[model samples]
Structures are given as structure tokens and as C-alpha cells.
Target: MKNNTPSTAHLKGTRTETAHDGNAKVWLNGKQLNLQASLKYCSKSPTGFNWGYGGSGPAQLAHEVCRQLYGLETANLVFQDFKWRFLVTIEGDTFDLTLELEEFNVGHVMPLIETAEDTDLCETQNGPTGHGETCYFDADQGL
Candidate 1:
């Protein structure tokens, strides 16, 4: 399938770093961010739709880091399927922020997929309802 994700180069500047002390520290325009916090923010599903996965976790974390670093309203991520390469952009300059999973202890916070009924409700003409709700086969139940 074709990837439709947009670029983040229009934000501000790029922040790059490698994993250090079990966390990745990112610097952008002299501001600093601890990626451990980013992991926590991204690991949780905002919509509670799908439990965060390794694939989406990094993307979400990167997007958030970009926002904090550059004060950008939006950020985007593009992933290379093989070996899990992620190309993220914020606003100004595009650069790579390398994060090694092992170095950052990513496995500890990584989300798992499981089968379960979705207790979340949806909006309807009358109100919120679960009449047509379906079970989530790959959801994170722990979170």
C-alpha cells in the first residue's frame, strides 16, 4: 500500500540524538527533552482504540518531541518497513534522531496486542451507544 503520511519539515529545526542512560535526550534549538517521557506519552492510546504498538509508539513519541522542541502545532512520521527505519520531521530542518531500542529500554514500555471487547462507546444520533461496537483483536488490555 502507498504511504500517505505528510512531511514535518515546515516546523522549525531538527533534533537528533542516540540512546543514552536508558533514555534518549533530544535537543532542538537549545531546548532539551527526555525521550523517556515521550515513550510514556506515546505508549498510551489517546482514543484508546488500539493499544500503542512498537510501530506507532516511536512515531507518536517523535511527533510529540518535535512539538515540544519547536513549539510546532503538528509533526509527521514516515516509516521504512525494513529494519524499522523512521523518518520524522518537525518544522525547519530535516534530520535523523537515532534511537536504539535496547539502549532506551523500549521493550519495557512497548505495547502488546490482545483480544478483548471494547468497552468504549461511540456517538450516535440519540447518544453514545455500543450496539454496533466490535471486539478489538489487537488491543492493549493492560493500559
Candidate 2:
């Protein structure tokens, strides 16, 4: 049978290169990804986004990427795993990470992230939902 999933080939076009001498940069589909959105969602990482380690900044970065590429709903579902898999794995002082956004999307939707116990995700002023102390999910909600 032929494949029917959306093509991410368009997403493969990336342009994240920046002056490495300064702060680290992340680009998606050939554009710079700013920290403003990330900060608005999660007030952590006042200094800005970072990766190669587990921290608030990485969490924000992961959240932002998932939020932008997929949507806030999916971001809440897959961000923690996204953080561990991509952001935390990026290393070095001057690293430019360009990833296949849809690859994350294809593997991480629906049943995989359908349960709250599976995600350990919570709601906070600076967290996913930007509400309450903890957030829960309705598995039937679907992606």
C-alpha cells in the first residue's frame, strides 16, 4: 500500500545558521525560532532557550518547537519526551540544531501520549496549559 502521511520534505528546508560567537540559536524550516513564545507559555528560562541538558530552558525550547510545529495541545502531550529525545541530546557551546519537525509529530501523537500518567505533565502559570497547578487529559479527546 502507498503511504498517506503528510510529507515533511517541505519541513526539511532549514536555515538555522547564526553567528556562533554569540548566544546559541535554533532554526526551524530555514528561520530563526525566537524565545518569546516559549517564555509566554513557560516563564522559566528568563535567560533564554538552551539544550544538551535537562532544564527549564530545554523544556521551553521543546515546548515551543512542539507548540509551533504541531500545536499547543500536542505540545502538552509530547513535550517532555521531545525534551529528553532532542533538546537534551544537543551539546556544545555553539550548536545549531536543525531537526525534522514532522518526524517528532509522526511518532508521538495519539495513543502514545493519550494518558496523563504517561506524560507526568502538569499545568502551571508558565507551563503547558498556563492554568492550574496540574493538568489532566481526556484520552478520548484524540489528537
Candidate 3:
């Protein structure tokens, strides 16, 4: 049978487990950023998986993802289980990003599978948001 978790299968690399606390911090170039950021896995939702602060969409979400995933040469992030904090500078634009994990929602983390009917969610400059409706693994449960 196919697995039911998105965190355990999609991210194929070294990862560490963290405790859920609803708060954490991410940094870049020795600078601190957002503190109330949330991240949740949504491997089973229609809108596909999304990571953002509060209910903000695409642009903000893209920045949040890139912040944590981006770095000068490498990006080090501390997954405080229930929260994420990071600093993001899109190419040259700078911004502080925070993500909050809500109830470990699986549907919010899955990437949006491209459908013939639905066009990809486009950002002004960030290309595809990668919120595709299918995540081979769960972001909450490590592999």
C-alpha cells in the first residue's frame, strides 16, 4: 500500500526531529527574522500544500519558502516542531519570514499536482510556487 504521510517520503535528505512548540527562529548572514511563522503538511488538500504566515497567499508564501530554503551558500534552519523562522532575500530583495505550524495539517504541505484543468500558480518573479498537490513524503513526519 502507498504511504499516507508527505513528510516521510518527499524530502529525501538528512533531517532531524524537533519538538512542537508553535515558535522558532530562522536566520541568515547572522541576522534574525520572523518569530511566529508556521508550517503545516497538507498532502491531501485540493489547493495543494502551502507554507505562509496567517492566511497570506502566493507572493508571501513563496518568499517564506525561499527564505528558509535559500542561502548565500547554505541555509541552516531550526525546525522548532511547531514554528519556523528564516530570513529571505529574493535575488536582491530582503524580507524577514516566519511560518507557524497549524495542527500538523497534512494537506497544507503536499505539492499541487499539475492538472489539465488547473494552471500553475504563478508569482510575479518567483516562477512556480511548487505547492503541487502531491508530496512523496510528509513534512511533519521525518523519514
TM-score of each: 0.27, 0.61, 0.21
Question: What is the full ranking by TM-score, best candidate first?
Answer: 2, 1, 3
* Minimal lDDT window, size 10, model 2: 7-16
lDDT for each of the candidates? 0.29, 0.56, 0.26
TM-score between model 2 and native? 0.61
Which residue pairs in model 2 clash with each other?
14-30, 15-30, 42-126
Off by over 4 Å in 1: 1-23, 44-61, 69-143
Best by lDDT: 2
Tens digits of per-residue lDDT, candidate 2, 92-141, equal 64454455546655577544444434544334553355431126444555
Largest TM-score belongs to which candidate? 2
The CA lDDT at 21 in model 1 is: 26
Better of 1 and 2 by lDDT: 2
Compared with the true structure, the alpha-carbon lDDT of candidate 2 equals 0.56
